[model samples]
Target: MRTAATILDFQHVTKKFGKTIAVNDVTFQVKEGEVYGLLGPNGAGKTTVIKSIVGHLRPSSGSITISSYDLQKEFADAIDFVGAVVEYPMHYEYMSGYQNLKLTANMYPEVTKARIEEVIELVGLQGRIDEPVRKYSLGMRQRLALAQSILNYPQLLILDEPMNGLDPLGMRDLRNLLRSLAANGMSILVSSHILEEMELMCDRIGIMSHGYMIAERNMDEIHHAQTPVYLVRVNDPEEALKLLSEEYGEQLHAKEAVGGRIEVETTLISASQINRILIKAGIEVQEIHEKKQSLEELYLQLTGGAEIE
Candidate 1:
């Protein structure tokens, strides 16, 4: 099987503001057609990293390359492959969406009227394409911004807080759109406070904390790596807890009696073994199932409960 090429590469990149180190020695890569999510709390340097990629802020040291072109050495060539909607989408409120798109299209030599129509349809803004920007909802405005961003057919797309003001339906629409784009070979780097959405949208995620890339993992691997918390219900919860506690002792990671059920957390013992033990001890084993740790739970555990900004 052929490996995908790296679309975005960050090599020991660091960014500082006077005395404050906003980003420190971060190294990661976004592969072709991959959706890479950037996650962090407020002041964790996620914005700093995004700004550095978009050329809004220059790195203090190290290197960054997009689509194989050096960001600092061949800035024009590097930036040509990038399209971004940083912070929030901006447009003239008085002008129509079509007019705004036309204005943005003027900046790119290859953006044609047919291409504009194609993007309008791609973002599901066909009916509202000619509507005044001020008359459009936040979701509509976001769609327009997305349409503008992809007008030049950029190989890499960057989105910062793209779902900030969007509703459930709008969020789902945007998510599906991004998935479709990635499927068609456009690599995306996105940062968001919405962990649940990020978990659903991204193939892999890189977590930042206090300006450091603390953790990076594939979503599939995260799912597989989760230690299962088995919820086992029994006729006698107290007896089951006592028996397991005495039998396992320190080997039992955690054991709690929740109403009539016993929630057991362990990596050393299997759920079937627990069930067999209870059954053999004359304790009726009712229902038992495993609950895996979610992305939000993992994020909280990793960040020490720091609230996502």
Candidate 2:
């Protein structure tokens, strides 16, 4: 179980670009050892929120605190506990991966050669650490960037679309790495358009739309929030549908699905109960199971089917 200590807090933060409101009164928190996901479609102000958190842009109103240090008042101190890869991981392409890390390590007084080597190994880039970054694959570069971010052993890490150009293997590797980090007590705030990945990675998610936070929910809560829908395949689907409808009435909705299956929608009824009802009514139940709801479906429902970009 994760602790209740809040690692990062955004309280009614708002950011404006002249006449345009990029982020409006958004508030959320990342607890210690939690992986928090920020999800939204294009033009949903996800970038603005990330920027504000990373100090690229200041919130016009409200407050942001990192490890209890106010971002506006104690900029340096608040940022000390943060490590971020916003938008893209920038590096000196001509420099070797080791060299790039060495340069970054120069910024932190306590980062020793042993610490640098440790991070490289931790990121699984030890073998190719001496290679020029220009020759590294996108995944390798991302790993290097992650190594750089954690060189100082920060309490919170923020990533923006860290999976953008990664292949399946790369994505899996990064996902495992993140989960491992979170398990060891690193709080992460990541923004991404990939709903499936977010669903797998985040403990809780805050969804944004049109510059406003529409919803913030734990993964388990989101899953449970879905109305349980069951697909029942029987000898007589039409009869089963009619029997269910007549018996359950407003308690559930039953309809004929493709392939002569009965699609049952209900929150008040269980699959086993429906099966028993059908069997008791002389209907032969061939199969009965609840249809799992995906995070993409939930996201679509919350965003009004907005295209995830």
Candidate 3:
């Protein structure tokens, strides 16, 4: 049994197409009110997992549960509490945004006009709700897609490539919208190749590659690569670099950085240790501090330089 108080669960799930394995022995849980990320570069089986969870693709083995109901057995009931966008969410281009939502909402008896309006407003498409979908910008279309997913006030939302093709302002707005959804008790799993955005947007991320989940962790755990390295602008960088490379290469990894500064990667030595080391070598320490490990660096480290296809 999954003991993670899960709102969504995938247990030993596997999917195959002829000879190709799209997803293999994958397992993960998304808890309530949390933004979970299914992160990988393209062709990493992220889309397969999302489709399986939403019941669009049945697993070859194991099972799926949504809100504690088995998807295979409960079927409709299990799917009832879920909203999703597998691949790019397709919308009828000729229809008005409101009309498109109405058509989609009619496919399920639980949705009403008020429910549609609520979702439309929530996705920030209310001002343009009556406009034709074809006239909408790419970001607006993305928002409309999100609106379609939320028409039922679903307890769980599964969005694949939720941030695809959005501008800076759109991504920012979408991030805030997702955070707000989690705050109001909605469990969300977003699948995308945009790892940097996912790092900032998701509460925790589950990384998938080569048809399965390779890693999963919170932000702190993912970016724990921060070391005691500082930038130093010295008067004699040539001398400092040679001296440090020759003597302190084991303890202090120093290299020439931009602006004629020396960036050193060192152990958890203190500020005093930095001063003593520089003074002992007759190298004037211009500045010494710490540097936060960016997600891009950590992503490369964790994924082993695997870029999203």
What candidate 3 gets wrong by more than 4 Å, as runs, is: 1-4, 107-112, 220-268, 271-294
Tens-digit per-residue lDDT, 1-101, candidate 3: 54446899889998999888889899999998899998887788998898888888888997899988999999999998898877766788889999999
Two-way TM-score contest, 2 vs 3, winner: 2
What tens digits encode model 1's per-residue C-alpha lDDT throughout 42-120? 8888888999999999999989999889999999999999999888688999999999999999998888899999999
RMSD of each: 5.7, 5.5, 6.6
| Per-candidate TM-score against the hidden true structure | 0.80, 0.79, 0.76
- Per residue, candidate 2 scores C-alpha lDDT tens digits across 142-173 of 88898999899889999988898788877888
User: Over all chains combined, what TM-score does candidate 2 have?
Assistant: 0.79
lDDT score of residue 233 within candidate 2 = 93
lDDT of 3: 0.83
Rank order by TM-score, top first? Answer: 1, 2, 3
Q: How much lDDT does each candidate structure score? A: 0.89, 0.89, 0.83
22 Cα displacement, candidate 2 (Å): 1.4
